[model samples]
Structure formats: structure tokens, C-alpha cells
Target: MNRCSFCNRSADDVDTLVAGAGVYICNDCVALSADIIKSKPAGPKRTTPVWEGVDDDALLAHLPRIDAIRHQVDDDLRSWVGEARRRGMSWDRIGEALGMRRQSAWERFS
Candidate 1:
């Protein structure tokens, strides 16, 4: 089943949802976000990348943080796929979700 991109609630759990390109948001989240936007003024637009102004030395120093985040996300993906397998979701479905071939998904995660 499809899930909200922000709240992670499945389609069966929400009353309404709108689909965007490769993303989904439910009505509850839309209403909550609208309230948040009303309460806080928008900030200035960021016309440049966040890392654009950083010096080479400072950027190199951030490599460990980025690496750690990547590792954590990798671990999370493995666990999520493992749980989906336990729930009897087919390898084809998993591969489709991951945009890979079923054999590749099984070889990677199984």
C-alpha cells in the first residue's frame, strides 16, 4: 500500500491522499502543514546550495558526518526490507519499490 511521504501512514490509515511525482501526502498532513505555515512566516529563499560557500577544509571535515548519515540510512533500508520480507511481500514487489530487478533485490537483501 502507498504511504504518506512525511507521516509514513499507509493509504488504508488515511481518509484522503494526493499523489505527486514519486511522493504521496495525506489530507491530515496537508491540514497540519497549512496550520504550521499560517503560524510561521516564510524565510528567505535559498538561491544557492548550502555547501556552496564552505572552504575545502571545512567541507572535508563534514565528510564523516555525511558518511555516518549514509551508513545509518543503509542500515534502515536493510531492516525495512527485511521486515517487508517477513510480512510476505514478494521480491518482485520489493524490487519494484526499489526500482531494481527482482533477482537483484533478492541478491542484495535476501
Candidate 2:
């Protein structure tokens, strides 16, 4: 499943997502962005650099969530490929969807 680039919310968590060349934004995020744009003053400024305040403890805490998302996405991909094959889709097309060669896709997912 795809996740919003800004909020990290998965596709399952949001109603819809606007996909772009290499990014996705969930509906909730899109609304938030629109609101932000309309109200222009912006949030308060921060003195710290991005992630500079993220200690090892916080990083370690987020690791499992990241891993879970990765595993879920991988499982979704495998199931989607299986379904596509069942529906008479070609390996070449599957490979194209994955941006890989047919042999590579087969070798990886078949």
C-alpha cells in the first residue's frame, strides 16, 4: 500500500490519495495543505533542525512501525501480483507496473 509522503498515513488509513510521479498525498493531508494555504500565517518557527531533537530512544521506538509498514506493503504487492496473474495479466505487464524486467519480476515475485 502507498503512504502519504507528508503524513506517513497508509492508503488504508485514508479515503484517497493523489499520486504523482514519485509521491503520494492522502486526502486528509490534502485538506490540511489546502487549509494551510488559505490561512497563510504559518505555524510557529522552530529553532531546532529537523530530527535534531529525535533521540535514540525515539528513533528506536519508531523502528517497529516503519518495519510493519514495510512488511505490509510487501505482502500487499505479492497478493496483488497473484491476483493479477489469476485475472490473466501478463508477467511483462506486471514487470512494467513494478518498473522492472519481466524476468526480474517473475524471479522476485513468482
Candidate 3:
């Protein structure tokens, strides 16, 4: 069975499976990707890749700070999402910002 290239969902789990050039995309990923593409605002998107260079010991030492920072980021995101909604942004647009489907974003944030 083929797995989705993006989310790694197996073909058996999805309602439909699509393949092209040795790559597979399941129905859920397709819908999410479509929403992301269609709802993208007109602008250049910037992505910063994470570097996995930290040693295990160092990572363990930083766990507390990492958890705190993660919580801070979550709180900031919620505040930003609320602000965006107040500014008349659609859930689709918010989902695009968070790299998820509108329904998923609504489920998480609303």
C-alpha cells in the first residue's frame, strides 16, 4: 500500500488515493493542500528550516525552557488568530496561516 508523501497516511485509511510521478497524496492531504493554496494571501511566504544539531543531553537540559517557549508561542498564536478574526479574516485564511484546513483550524482555535 502506498503512503501519502506529505502526511504519511496509508492508502487504506483515506477515502481516495492519487499518485503521480512515484508520489502519492491521500484525500485528506489533497483537501488541506487545496485549502492552503486557494486561501493563501497575495504575498511571499517565508519558511525557516529547523536545524537538528543539538545533542541529546543538551536537548534534555533545555526541555523546561522549550516547553515554556512552546506554551508562549501557542498563546501568541491564539491572540493573533483572535486579532485576525476581528479584522474580518475568514477561517480559511487563518488556516492557511497555520498550515491546516479551515475545519481543523476552527476545531483547534474556535
lDDT of 2 by residue, 11-94 (tens): 898999877544577899889999978977767865787568799998787777667656656766787899999999999999
RMSD to the true structure for each prediction, in A, is: 9.5, 6.0, 19.2
User: Candidate 1, overall lDDT?
Assistant: 0.81
User: Where does the lowest 10-residue lDDT sum fall in candidate 1?
Assistant: 65-74
For residues 1-110, could you state the per-residue lDDT of candidate 1 as single tens digits? 56666666668999997876446789999999999878876788558997899999998987765655455456668878999999999999999999999999999998
For model 3, how does the per-residue alpha-carbon lDDT over 1-110 read when each residue is reduced to its tens digit? 45665666567888997875445678898899999899999977746433377778877866765555445456657878888999999999999987999999999889
Candidate models: Cα lDDT each? 0.81, 0.81, 0.75
Give me the runs in candidate 2 sitting further than 4 Å from their true place: 1-50
Clashes found in each candidate (C-alpha, N, C closer than 3 A) = 0, 0, 0
Clashing pairs in 1: none
Return the clash pairs for model 3, or none.
none
Best by TM-score: 1
Clashes of 1: 0
TM-scores, each model vs. reference: 0.60, 0.56, 0.47
